[model samples]
Target: MSAAAPSAQPKLRVKNATKAYNTRSGELVAIDRCSLDVKAGEIVSIVGPSGCGKTTLLWSMSGLHKLSSGEVLLDGKPVNGPNPEIGMVFQDANLLPWRNLDANINFPFEIKGTKPDRAWIDDLLGRVGLSGFGGRFPRELSGGMQQRAALVRALSFKPSVLLMDEPFGALDAFTREEMNQLVEEIWMAAPTTIVLITHSIEEAIFLSDRIVVMSPRPGRVAAVHDVPFARPRSLEIMSTREVFDLTNVIKREIVGEQKSRYVRSSDAPVAQSAV
Candidate 1:
């Protein structure tokens, strides 16, 4: 294991968590007996194949979904429902069409009927490079800019944890890269524990302090890798042999787990056809 965080207790813990749904066929287990810890001020990326419960885990972390077994705890408190300290940014911008960027970013406070510190929001806008665009509508922005706004909106509450579900998955390659850099910048400016669910290996490597690799469906912790690079990392680090080797190691683990899954399915007995 990598060196423990300076603090004694984890900021977030997912312990033996399992999530399942009762379907027509049977119980569908999305995640099984998964356990992990994220330290305060850390950025952790959860990467896995589709149907591997990456999003399920994100929901659990955010207190939006309850686990079938075990639990997710934030600051030693159980996450049984949507907690105020947690903020989520989904795959889509999910912006209200009629609301201007400033209004949309302030929507969270509006719902709570709470007044927010406009100065903080302004600082965030500047940090995310959206300083002057707050008056613009969502439609006026490009895909990347819209997503950047989405991120700022999530942070406007100053939540302790930010749960991102493939926020850049829909963007073009260049836009995605730009957003990745933007995320790093934002995190550095104002630290928060972040849990990002993504399929991009390079993105994970670039943004995370640690990368948690999940197994195939009924996902479990396949491996946990502590990113060796120093923070305020740049895209140049992606070209190094160390990054390449680490990427290959994760790929092999996923591939190997998939092969095992195929073998198990093939070994199951087939039902005989009726006469």
Candidate 2:
């Protein structure tokens, strides 16, 4: 038999990543020896309980936060600081109050000392349903519209990897669903590697190729699930039985971690009293 071809290297790799902070009490570990790998053009979502270091992991992947140990690599090269190939979208729109939508979207180009692509920018705005509204300021747009602009801003530079941290957490249910659909459409149109941090199990199932569930504080990867659904998924798919079951499975992982933490804390006092 002929030798099988080797697997392709991951587009992004997190090797035994550990992040910590020095506070008044001492060192605080946020993520403990967590590692992950993302293939090219893959959409991966990380879901966990609150304060489980989901944001910290995302930030480390973006090179915005320095890991206390191990390393993050993009295309096999270490990412020690912000790189043009990586783009980030935070929970807030964070658009410049004074700059109009067009200018705000072009801000990355300005920082990179490159000229903005007007045609591409127009197409992005159109795809996100903000075609002619580019000339308006952020104050003139609604929450969803502002977020659409923020998404465009991150994509304006055509980064290879996009890191999103609860980008739609502030939106209403209806709006959030719409934004999710919009994200699916955009991602289909232009396939970019994406790593998303979200608390919503349904959102993770609706948007990701795979889902990574993290444990409570000092977060570690509790479980990793490959979404069985095919691409170009619609919002109606969220109502299916398979999706419901998968959502519950992911939810149990998070809730189980929370319960374990509670048990550990509760048992500590009893053991001390027994002594």
Candidate 3:
């Protein structure tokens, strides 16, 4: 008889992670005993209401913030600090005003004391529709263009995992949609493990393999929804009945959490649904 197939291992693991801040009004818990697992080359998005500690959880996963308890592990090793294997893209482009687009994308290489791969950088620029705009400074580019450059910069080093915190939040609706399409195209061309934080349920549904919903303050994983659509998804998928039903389900979960005045900080049972 043939041997049994081995289960795929998670490229990134968050085990009982908790983060707290000592605010002026005593200690405030941001996230409590939140745990998640992301397989290699999969895109997972976290959606929740504002101040639900989604960003805090993403930051903790990136090793930008330390956890008060539990741990984030990459490749089965604890992540105590920023690892070169992880790349981040923030809401703002955060590009250097003085540096042109080409230089900005090469910044990671410089930081690592390595030479930039001109060919690869150019290919990335072309892929994102910024081929000839490399010489242009951030100020000269539109908001969408700036974000494209930022995305390229984060991917320039070819990190194993990419963490995006509402990277397209600043763009107009039309432009944001365009960027979303662009991101999907890029991911299809070269798959990467991505963990995204967003308030837009539609965005999460469009982009993620799994959607993780968090409770309000002192966030915990309230639910996890597996997206059923195949890869290379189009905007039309957003209007489908499956997408609409899934969106409503997730919205209800967030709304239910918000209505509850008292939220538990300790670990709670997480609901999982496949759609």
The candidate scoring highest on lDDT is 2
Q: Pick by TM-score: which candidate is best?
A: 2
lDDT score for residue 35 of model 1: 98
Misplaced by over 4 Å in model 3 are: 1-6, 262-275
CA lDDT of 41 in candidate 2?
86
Taking the candidates one at a time, how many backbone clashes does each contain?
Answer: 0, 0, 0
Deviation in angstroms for 101 in model 1?
Answer: 1.1
The better-scoring model by TM-score among 2 and 3 is 2
Better of 2 and 3 by lDDT: 2
Residue pairs clashing in model 3 are none
Global lDDT scores for all candidate models: 0.89, 0.90, 0.88
- How high is the lDDT of residue 91 in model 2? 95
RMSD per candidate (Å) reads: 3.2, 4.0, 6.0
Candidate 1: what lDDT?
0.89
TM-score of each: 0.94, 0.94, 0.92
Which digits, one per residue and each the tens of the lDDT, describe model 2 over residues 209-256?
A: 999999987889999998978778888899999999999898888998
Q: How well does candidate 2 score on lDDT at residue 200? A: 83
